[model samples]
Target: MSALAMNETLTIARLGQRGDGVAETVQGQVFVPFALPGESVRAVRDGDRAQVVEILTPSASRIAAICPLFTRCGGCAAQHMGEGLYAEWKRQQVVTALSRAGLETEVLPVVDAHGVGRRRVTFHARREDDGMRVGFMVAGTHDLIEVQACPVLAPGLERAPIVAQHLANRLRASNKPLDIQLTASEAGLDVDIRGHGPAGDALRRQLTEAAERLDLARLAMHGEIIVERRAPFQLMGKAAVTPAPGGFLQATSEGEAMLSRLVLDAIPKAKRVADLFAGCGPFSVRLAEKAQVSAFESDKAAIQALSRAANHTQGLKPVAAEARDLFRRPLLEHELNVFDAVVLDPPRAGAEAQVKRLAASKVPLVAYVSCDVGSFARDAALLVAGGYALERVTPVDQFRYSAHIELVGVFRKTAGRK
Candidate 1:
């Protein structure tokens, strides 16, 4: 083999943003998958990336991965790191992102929100000559890695793999690629199958039978319900919500609770609050427990779900939900000033346009919940420039072992400051 493709010993110096270990090579920095900082490894180098051939010296922080499918399945990245290293790595992701944006604020240690593991997962299914394979894709590849079980899944989803395979088998005749999404809800497993295109009435009947046999709570194809044995309900605070099929949700139940707690605690004195980019009222329903909340979201289905949940729940402060694309038409300064505080849990893009409005508004408190730290940092800088003191940021690790980090930040308006 040429030097470029031969096995070479390298010392991992640090973990990169994607949880890959970085080593300073003679050529440049080489990234090795499944390697850890302070570990020396023999790997086959191909340009800037390498596959570890052997671990010559292991890092002290390295631990046995809980999942047997750890390195094979692309579901997790930091399974090898010990608890201390894992927590620090996740927390530093927030701190570094904020620092790059020139916003200096206290970032607390990561909160462990991996309670009962992930409640939702998507398994890709493809048919082979022998049979159909269902599991996660290999890291950086389209190839599927068959999984019998996943340690990172909640107990309610222990049968997700089996259920996915069963569904795939039912649709095997389509000969098209399939993506099956299963979510653990109070009613049972809510399943949504995609990638096989529109389903005919015949296929829907077949799927309905399959769902019945498997005892599924509900089944949908491409977000269209095939069978509804029961409503897939999720509890947000005291409200029972039936989120739109395949809608966005926090990875874990615990993650949502932690993020909600942080948001609620930040604006305790506020009477009226605005929830921008609110999805199915996770925070809105909870915030309504103590304050009147106005929620704005782009998805009409989500808005309807939130409204229905709010209306059905008792003893909650008035919750008014409106379907408005905040990106195109953010609430203006005058409209925003009506609320004492704003709690926004935007998508990964963050709420740049809406934050700009909040920055100029008289809203005294802003609780920002974010999934992407880079975008969050950029918006945080904008808020600080507008005279909002970023009190603190807390990183919550719901996607454990993965590089993704969620955070909640509290920003208070400074009196007489621009």
Candidate 2:
């Protein structure tokens, strides 16, 4: 391509789903990062992607970014969008996805569940020629951007980057890449290190010392405990749950609370509830407070943690926690008859198999929680085809400033049980 063709000033028509600005080029649509709609930007063009060289005309909805590493860090997107534009953009993501699936319904406004910022973060560490470099990867690139602090993290994780760096320094001799996941818990910071094959006794002892020095509650390597200064826990409703090392957790405390509230509100009078793909019983333990909950998940450790939390907490109804991979063996339609309501918080792939069974079952209500809109829309279409009405969908923003969006959709059986 010629220099003029490669470097052109383009007008951004709109924002794409991934938070990139869409500019119609002669070839097709070129996605430009950090550019907003109604703006003219000079960019260095690749095939279908472009890097913004200058914002020739800034959008009125553009605002100053909060983080110094905004574009370079790649951890956040849409940080420059004004509050109004950002909210609408996120909500429209759900609306657009559902519309494409031919399942149009009331999509409530986007809920800002980013209160106090994220409680969990994973820092990537690489041992370079100079030393160990620790931080997040740049967007679409493997290059690490060294981060000292991240404003998006909860105050409890204020020292996360420093702690990660210290841990990296300790393992620099191994010369292996590391992924350090840190979660701020009720007791203190809970950390798990990955990619450090097997820890020798000497290394374990050193990690124990490092954990103590860092004031960490617990430290583990690949889910195996190396040190336990204290049992780290998280408060879910009235119960305090000590999750499995480095297990899945909602990004923010407020996000979990918001999602739980939405789920609870949908099935107020249900006496029996089934929590599917339930990770560490975020919804199961809470749901047990009122109804008998049968929690199912593929992670045995998470189920054990959930059961222990339920057994220890008083005033909650019986919670039968079982370890089962729903993707392979979905609870059949007849088996689903025991529960009056079902709540699913599946991963990004969504619960296609489980949802299909629910679609044919006699279950009255379903509170479907999803992180990916496309997957959720596909599953919702299946449920609707099975004679369920998607009452409404509420989008929750937990990973603030990022393209990620969480949502809770309530489906009610409109036709008699098949």
Candidate 3:
């Protein structure tokens, strides 16, 4: 490549979906990280990807990053942008998705749900001769960046890196890279270590001692309990739920509550509700307060947890949980008719098969919660074509500083739809 081609000064025109600033060049388009729109920057280009060397003219929306390791840690993007631009970028993600789907509806402003940062964090730990390196991976690379502290973590989990390091040091004898998942719960820090093989009696004893010293509520290796100081429970609405080891939880408690509220508001009068793809009853437990809930999920452990929570909790309407894969056998139209409304929170792939059945069903109201905008748009288009009115969508800023945005889209079946 020519020197001029490799080293070029470019003006950022817009931000891409992954939060990279896009610059139109004669060679097509270049994507530069840590650069904002309307800013002129000098970058070293390799094909269409560029590394920002210097910001010649910074945009008005540019701001100093709060975290020193913002660009290097790969945990957050767009942190350099001001709050106004950041919020608009997140909201426009949903707007762009809806526009692509050929559907236009009022989208509420993005809700700031990233309160006090993420409650749960996963650290990548690799054993070394000196000790263990524990933290997140560098952007687009497998290089581990040892984080001393993270601003994005919940206050309760401020010492998570230290906790993870302690566990890693104790388990370093196994000589295995580990993924340590830490969740700050009511009891204490719930620790789940993955990528480690079955622990022998000696290793188990060491882990137990480490857990005790670190004051962990629970410690599990490969989803099997090594030590349990207390039940690491999370309160979902009125009920207390002990989620499965290393199971999915919303990044922040505030995000979970906001999503639940939006989902609840979408189906205000729903007496009988089906919580599809329900994981550990975050929504089901809340919905059960006002409606009879049938929660279906593929994870047996999660369903069991939900079932146990519902059975023990008092004053909640009947909540029945079943372990069934909705992708393979979605609730058919006839089976779906029994519910007054339905709330489905599918994974990133976005529940195509299940949505097809929902479109054919007589369920009057459907609230779709999605993490991926592209998949949501595709599924929303399907529902819109199937005699459903695309109601207002509210985008939730759960994963802040990143391109990912969660949305709750309400769809109501048109009149006279059988």
Best by lDDT: 2
Report the error of model 1 at residue 56, Å.
1.8
Clashing pairs in 3: none
RMSD of 1: 1.3
**After superposition, which runs of candidate 1 have C-alpha atoms over 4 Å from their true positions?**
1-3
Residue pairs of candidate 1 with colliding backbone atoms: none
lDDT for model 1: 0.92
The deviation in Å at residue 76 for candidate 3 is 0.7
lDDT of 1 by residue, 135-182 (tens): 899978899998888888899999999999999998999999999999
TM-score to native of every candidate shown = 0.97, 0.98, 0.98
Give the alpha-carbon lDDT of every model.
Answer: 0.92, 0.94, 0.92
> For candidate 2, which ten residues in a row score worst on lDDT?
1-10
Per-residue lDDT of candidate 3, residues 92-200 (tens digit): 9999999999999999999999998889999999987778888899998999999999888888898799999998988887788999999999899999999989999
Error of 2 at 251 (Å): 0.4
Candidate 2 per-residue lDDT, tens place, 158-178, comes to 999999999999999999999
